[model samples]
Target: MLILTWVFVVTAGLALAYAAASAIGAWRWSVAARNLVAELTAGRVAPAASRHHAAELAGLPAPVQRYFRAALTDGQPIVTAVSLTQSGLFNMSAVADQWKPFTATQAFATARPGFVWDANITLFPGVPVRVVDAFVAGEGLLRPTILGLYGLGTLQGTGEIARGELLRHFAESVWFPTALLPSQGVVWQAVDDTSANATMTDGPISVTMLFRFGVDDLITSVSVEGRATTVGTATVLMPWECRMSNYQTRDGMRVPLTGEALYITPQGEKPYFKGTIDTIVYEFAP
Candidate 1:
């Protein structure tokens, strides 16, 4: 009786396993179709979805359909204003009580070869002042403006911080050479742009990204929690928080300028960085 029962259990398990595989396969295939469609859109095969498909997709949820529409649009790199709150450990500014936090604004003008990320900042009190800077993302790069009134000057030769370096030193003390490339894919979930739950792993080291945002996806906050797993040791973890929000769009793209980032070191010391821009109003030349 025992032997017969074992045989039956094994047989049933195989059947269930087969069924599960079939289900997952079907799901993956569906996802593949969408991915293929996305790639096609990226490659300029079809700038707009066929009318029939667009109508069919309209039957889905609004956000999903919005994403679908965005995907179908021709690979005209989106040009929008990015107003980011600039702050960092290097700042000599203070966070006064009942006073506003560190903030700035930037005009994100994007095109093919590169995008010009221009920044403006007002770091003085009682004095209405602004600074401007432009950086090209694809081809033509802009130079960071010099804040004449304030002694704090732009990082001497860093007009265009390479995307590779930006993604690497994102929250790290310094840039890491072996950081994963952008093509790896970025998956982000948020309780708002101010607070987010994210995970990006390259190899042995896994980085946890957390953030806080202003009401309208103005990233008024950011946090990158790090975890280190060693061969024979327990894991090491850390936490920090920053906030930013407020924006001005030059084109149709929305950019968040009022933002902050909180950093905690391995030994547990807190630090903050904020984006600094003076004026940010988007105007489309073309």
Candidate 2:
């Protein structure tokens, strides 16, 4: 009985020690996250100038410097921004080659009123979907101006766009297909990367917005990729890649010049959709 009692005592002590250590680790992680975000925002260009110091920042994952050199570009600030509800058209081969309209709405912000937004998604055209009426929860840069004029036609309960998917895609869409984006504002974030994951048709693929910056420290392009399977087909899988590029300036702010999407199925089917935006009518109304 004494031996069993001693074992129980030892086990309880070890468990308590483990619990304490875990609590301490979580606390440290929280504090580190706070400091990291602070550095990302206020650190800005000054932080960029000090590459050695920038490397020390805990805001981004250590691999961030290697994967995203734009974060350390000259004159570029640690920009956080958003793309509000954008309505577009898309066509898919999974659903009897059905073409439908899609409306994507996101609400975001930054610490400052300045931000550069480059976001795009492929949709079915000739379907003309309308932005009925909607609201964004996180009001970063658009809190005072852009939000009001935009999403004026959004609808209620169509659904709220997930902010996490928005940020993950935001990281990808910022560069490559587009010029680049730079700004000092608030944007969205996600714990997981969704674009690279596998998805099925009729599974209601939540829209993803890829973000990265281009040359001139301005937002150049944005892209969203989605996939699905044929509803009643013989186990056929279709993969799609859509990218929006070509940026134009309206009243000093840059907007995408053209948006393009490509859909590919294992059965040799490629449907293409493209859009040309003539002018951007919105501005940062500070």
Best candidate, TM-score: 1
Output the number of the lDDT-best candidate: 2
> After TM-score superposition, what is the CA distance of residue 249 in candidate 1 from its true location, in Å?
2.9
Question: What range of 10 consecutive residues in model 1 has the weakest lDDT sum?
Answer: 173-182
Candidate 2 TM-score, true structure as reference: 0.32
Q: What's the C-alpha lDDT at position 113 in model 1?
A: 14
Model 2 agreement with the true structure over 1-286: per-residue lDDT tens digits: 9999999999999988766654664455345334433433442232111112333334543222222343333322332333344444446444355655554433222322112222222233321222211112221111111211223221122122222223323333332211122121122333232222211111132344443334443333333443332335332324455454665443333345566555555556455444454333331212
Report the Cα lDDT for residue 180, model 2: 22
For model 1, the stretches where C-alpha displacement exceeds 4 angstroms are 1-184, 189-208, 211-220, 227-240, 265-269, 279-286
Q: If scored against the real structure, what TM-score would every candidate get?
A: 0.33, 0.32
Candidate 1 TM-score, true structure as reference: 0.33
